[model samples]
Target: MVTTSIPTTTKSWTVLGTDGFDSLKFSKDTPLPAVSDYEVLVKFHAASLNYRDLIIPKGQYPFAQKPGIVPGSDGAGEVVAVGNKVTLFKPGAKVVTLFNQGHLGGSLNPQTSATGLGGVIDGTLRQYGTFNENGLVDMPASLNWQEASTLSCAALTAWNALYGLNKLQPGQTVLTQGTGGVSIFAAQFAIAAGATVISTTSSAEKGELLKKLGVDHVINYNETPDWGAKAKELTPKGEGVDHIVEVGGPTTMEQSLNAIKIDGTITIIGFLGGVQGEKQPGFLDALVRMCTVRGVLVGNRVQFEEMNRAIEANKIKPVVDPKVFSLEDAKSAYQYMWDRKHFGKLTIKIE
Candidate 1:
């Protein structure tokens, strides 16, 4: 029932190659693709940055195909066009899409086609993008584009790892690493679930911030090189933590394993520390001793909806960093994230 004015064409930022993102290129000549019966066209208002965007230039991911691919997976916007059969969202509604197009409900299927925005397909960094209605969720009344953008990838991934896979309990202890998007959301989600959360950071200042967010313990990894042992010591059982939201990959994998309870769950999500680094000793034995290790891909649309419900019900807010950039400064945002100086989610505001 919501009807709105239609625009002829939109301007968008395009990632040509390793040279980095080119700003606000006019796309007046690029004709809008006709919406498929199940698809809707979105006019993006804001988008958030993730580490995945940083790897496209280096060719670290094989799926990142040719040049001219727009690179951003998380964003929120208003619906400007809807195909005949699109019933979930109508034109003029505010909505956000899942990071993964085809993979829904933890099941992989070719029906939806696992094409990722900004990688296999053009992404939302542009002013206009099209997606299947099934992949889109209505933005909550309380969230703006920036806040809704943060929910697509990082928040959903943490939700699935802690609640979906681990089913973390109210009194369970959770271990998280660093202050990056995923780790910070892990901390927030665990706290909201009434779980005891312990986080590690290289900066004491960020650790203090985490403590204020209801983190039960914050370990300064710089001062305590064996922070995993410290995490074990803090648990009520004095054994180890119940779950670990692992993001540091091999560099922190051994330590994460060491910090977990005998039958604890460790959800491996990213390689922020180093992709190919060596893991600590006793990893195999640790796994044999009843530990659960899982590699998490950012979740699907159903999980995104579930996470959004929790966000609305519990009144949880994402800890977004203060740095805001225009669409033109997206490259600078990438550089800042690469430097690892950001305390929380880094974002770009587009109108």
Candidate 2:
């Protein structure tokens, strides 16, 4: 591994308060932290956004956060410098940060729970940040920086939902809600795995994009209010879907319960529809249906590695929003995502 002179400061987007998007400010010269023996200094090229990024600024995330913290969990960059003890990555190697640095391959616990980035601590929405070696994973060579940046959080979460515990078999059916990063990746991964994908979106435009990504059916939730029943009707032989990537929380869970087959799985990942809805499903519905609900928190490092390998083999490319934002325009970028206009991952380019 080659070595280079470390810099003293780097540019970053810092959240000054939980006052929404306006609170995010561009820091022209945030001081860089020194790399310790087990750490590597990454020069981030690009970072991607998630739904949590939207709520964190409003202090809504369950994890504790600090003011003036750099807020992001997904990025890919070159390793400009590495500590003597860092053998996994070195100078010039391309890598992305794991959302949880402590939970590499085991079950979740307090220690891993405390290590979540962007919320538990400062995250990767900056040009340079030092990460523990264990938290860094190699980016697939087949993907560019923007595409690889999408993997750390949303992509890995989708992978965990589909294949982490309950593997989807060939000819099975999956129902994904919305065209966000996680749902889109779930559709792509399910299609690659030989499963039929049924996706829901807010607009026909976004629904068309999902169809292009190999979704067999795209249900416009606005047009089809009772999308769950529609999804059930669309499945093989009128049977319900085998799995659902449930990201809408309370607002969409009732329908998810209606759309899933007996003994099916629903991986509850996010609360995009917020905490409550007009009509919430009862526990009896899940009990009677014999459906399993597994809550996903991104994923572990081992699953991330497996997802990367699959990406490489399948030539999977993340659908990044074309409008690129610089670190200085991070606030507008957040607002763009908040507006719900983007069809795929929103990204920021770091120079």
Candidate 3:
């Protein structure tokens, strides 16, 4: 309506069909749609890949279908145009796309969950995107596009895991299970909250890096299969940790249980560890420790805003993989994410 950039063709990568990674196709002249009454146009500067980007392409993700759409959830950009009815954003405002476009606040529900960007809807792999005004938040001034792009999913999920049930308190201990985006974010958030952090990793090199990030102790899970017990022992008085960032799902849950205290919390975020007949956690597990086991989706819009304020205030920077990729190499970036060698979020610049 009050247009700065008019409706025109833009470049984008689209999953043409569900043929695994081979289905991803790029085009320079993808037709850009007109912004609706409440929609705003964004010129995406950067986007980060999540595990979903790896699994969804292979039809492996639960409740998520194959890609007939643009496939990126985390992105940071600047508003280039606004619809007549849009008031939340103006042209040139830096913004980050919300992971779930429909769920603004309160609890996440089925309908709201289905509104995940790059899943139920077209996502941020394009040079330009149009989103509902409610779907984007003001980007933190302290972060550049690359750092801000990591927030929509990984950072938000970590924030939700730590702060959802109860705000993480100072001096509590946290056990993080790897150096992935979510785990690193958890460690950073915990440290920022004045909490002690113990992390688990397979590589000694990565462990040293974790120490550099201010992790109190790094356990090599390969050597110490019972790292959970070791983690508990490291806690003050051997009581166990206040929170366990449970990314390993079934295989690592038992370890998590061992590392948790009688009323500690375990937030299940990812299932990177293969399910090798590890017993599914049951009521007995909860009964034994009287601990809370929660599953975290990314987060709601209000929480995203809250996390942004904290990140900006504390100058918390998201760890991004140094290997850069351009929009043309997004498919290759997907393969890199699948390799799981990168320490943090893999990103693509839309230029």
Q: Candidate 2 on 241-335: residue-level lDDT in tens?
A: 99999999999999999899988999999999999799988788899879998887888999999999999999889999998888778888888
lDDT of 1: 0.80
- State how far residue 67 of model 1 sits from its true place (Å): 4.2
Instruction: Return the TM-score for candidate 1, rounded to 2 decimals.
Output: 0.92
What would the TM-scores of all predictions be?
0.92, 0.97, 0.97
Off by over 4 Å in 2: none
CA displacement after TM-score superposition, residue 86 of candidate 3 (Å): 0.8
Write model 3 residue lDDT over 1-351, tens digit each, in one string: 877857598888887766689988888898988888899999999999998777777776776544478888999999988999999998999999999999899998888988989888889998999999999999999998898999999999999999999678999999998889999999999999999999999999999999998999999999999998999999999999999999888888988998998889999988888656357777798789889999988999999999999998888989998997999899999988888868888888987
Q: Top model by lDDT, which number?
A: 3
Any idea how many clashes model 2 has?
A: 0
Q: After superposition on all CA atoms, how large is the RMSD of candidate 3?
A: 1.3
Q: Give each prediction's root-mean-square deviation over alpha carbons.
A: 2.4, 1.2, 1.3
Candidate 3: clashing residue pairs, number? 0
